[model samples]
Target: MSGFDPRPLLGKALDQMGELITTTDDSQRDLPTPCADYTVSQLIDHIQAVVRRIGAVLSGQPFWSVPQSIESTDWPADWAEGRAATDAVLADDAILTREVQVPWGQSDGAAAAASYIGELAVHAWDLAAATGRSERLDPELAAAALPAYRAKVPAEPRGGDIPFGPVVEIGDDAGPYEKVVAWTGRDPQFAA
Candidate 1:
């Protein structure tokens, strides 16, 4: 991720995830998602939390101080605030050069931003699949995030803190987006 400005792509990924959050109605909150551990509401909350968490990291705050989940009915508004946090902090390119210590270990800001792009991309599909809005998914974001996912998460030894299941095999017809989630231990054919 060196020399690459992740702000633009990260912004796009966030916007894509935010739209999924905004469109998720309360009625669907109880529905299960591809992430077996999280309901639709839980997943949305995680998404918002991660955005805020990123902001905390960018501003040199303890990212773990941010809660891992929230229960919200007004996600669009919450999403705006979370987005604004990152927007304000990341506006200056200088922040990207800073050596920030994140929970995953110390690295420059760009690596941190690049790391979450793949995560958000997978969750975007999770939201879509859970909400019956898979049609709206942006495949390009998943495609962009694939290399990052591959570089970090391995294809085996999943469980516990790994947060991924064994990769579910996809057919040759599966698109780039499906492959991205699959690499993170997701089943491309997740039915819930």
Candidate 2:
């Protein structure tokens, strides 16, 4: 409503993740990621599902109406389809102020976009770490999203429906991206 736009930032982050997903080696599919119990292939499926579901939300569909998991042998095409759906709905700035219902609460387009930016940025890091592509990540995604995450999700009383663990501690050398993921309960030092 105040002319704030996080779409470009979200788009850039999503694009980075798309590149990471597309470039992941097939052999790495069974490898473990920083996300507990999620293999590279399973994480990729989760990213795809998140994309499709969020796109459905922006397109005014019920949140739970979309499938929870969408497997993909061709990640590039799957990513493109989700992006295309979101791009179509987000093309108009008018939607920025329009109200949308999310899992936690009702929010306008800009807030929804920022929230998703953080969510996907964290998942993107998971994908990168799972496939040894962490070095290719853009720090801006975490930098832009960290504050929103801190404001929205508390650091204490984790578990249950919260879906996040206690914040992990990182060293002095940790970058913004690392800190952001660490804040979300991921260990930035994880390797595939």
Candidate 3:
């Protein structure tokens, strides 16, 4: 596994997501995102849930026991709290060397963190696209996540057991954020 510390990339991706969450108005909650089944509100809750899971694994808690669904009464606050806690856990250098039980199985912390970063980045793009703020997402963050997606997330045709759907086709000239989104099974041209 790559020994590169994913904290910086993860932080950037989470920060991008935080920005998206902060700007989301209540009227846009029902909008459809590129995640296929999730509406804007549901996607926000899912992001919070995933962040909580990351924190649990990092803290040596039983990650599998964490609830997969988080309520969305006050998403910004909930996301902020989860982000702070997860960020604290990720800040530890030793986490990169330890093994963590991820949804796919056990993996070294570096790989696990990288996978989360990729997941968050792609979802941030989805939110951006749904909310008509796609231009606001950071291309640098998506570029950084591509290597992790390539190394950790399989490119094979997606099945029921896989978290992502089949990868969508994109042009060779597609930008970094578009490539990242398409790699995660979203069409870059997705419109709400």
Model 2, total clashes: 0
Q: Per-residue CA lDDT of candidate 3, range 1-192, in tens?
A: 665877887888888889899889999999999988899999988888888888788666666867876877898899889988898898888888788887778878887777877788888988999999988988988898887787666889576776787788888999999888888788999989
Each prediction's TM-score versus the true structure: 0.94, 0.94, 0.92
> Could you give candidate 2's per-residue lDDT for residues 1-192 as a string of tens digits?
378997898788778878888888888889998989589899888888887776667666666777766888888888899878877877877667877778887888788877888888898899888877788888888888899888877898778877888899888898988889998888988986
Candidate 1 structure quality by residue, lDDT tens digits, 1-192: 668889888888898888888878899999999999899989988888888888878777776878887566689998998899889988978768787767667878888877778878898999898888888988888988998778777787899766789988888888987899888887888776
> Candidate 3: lDDT of 117?
77
Q: After the best TM-score superposition of candidate 1, give how far the Cα of residue 61 lies from its true spot, in angstroms.
A: 2.3
lDDT, residue 125, model 1? 92
lDDT of each: 0.84, 0.83, 0.84
> Model 2's lDDT to the true fold?
0.83
What value of lDDT does candidate 3 attain over all alpha carbons?
0.84
Position 75, candidate 2: lDDT: 80
Per-prediction CA RMSD (Å): 1.3, 1.4, 1.6
For residue 95, what is the lDDT in candidate 2?
62
How well does candidate 3 score on lDDT at residue 97? 78
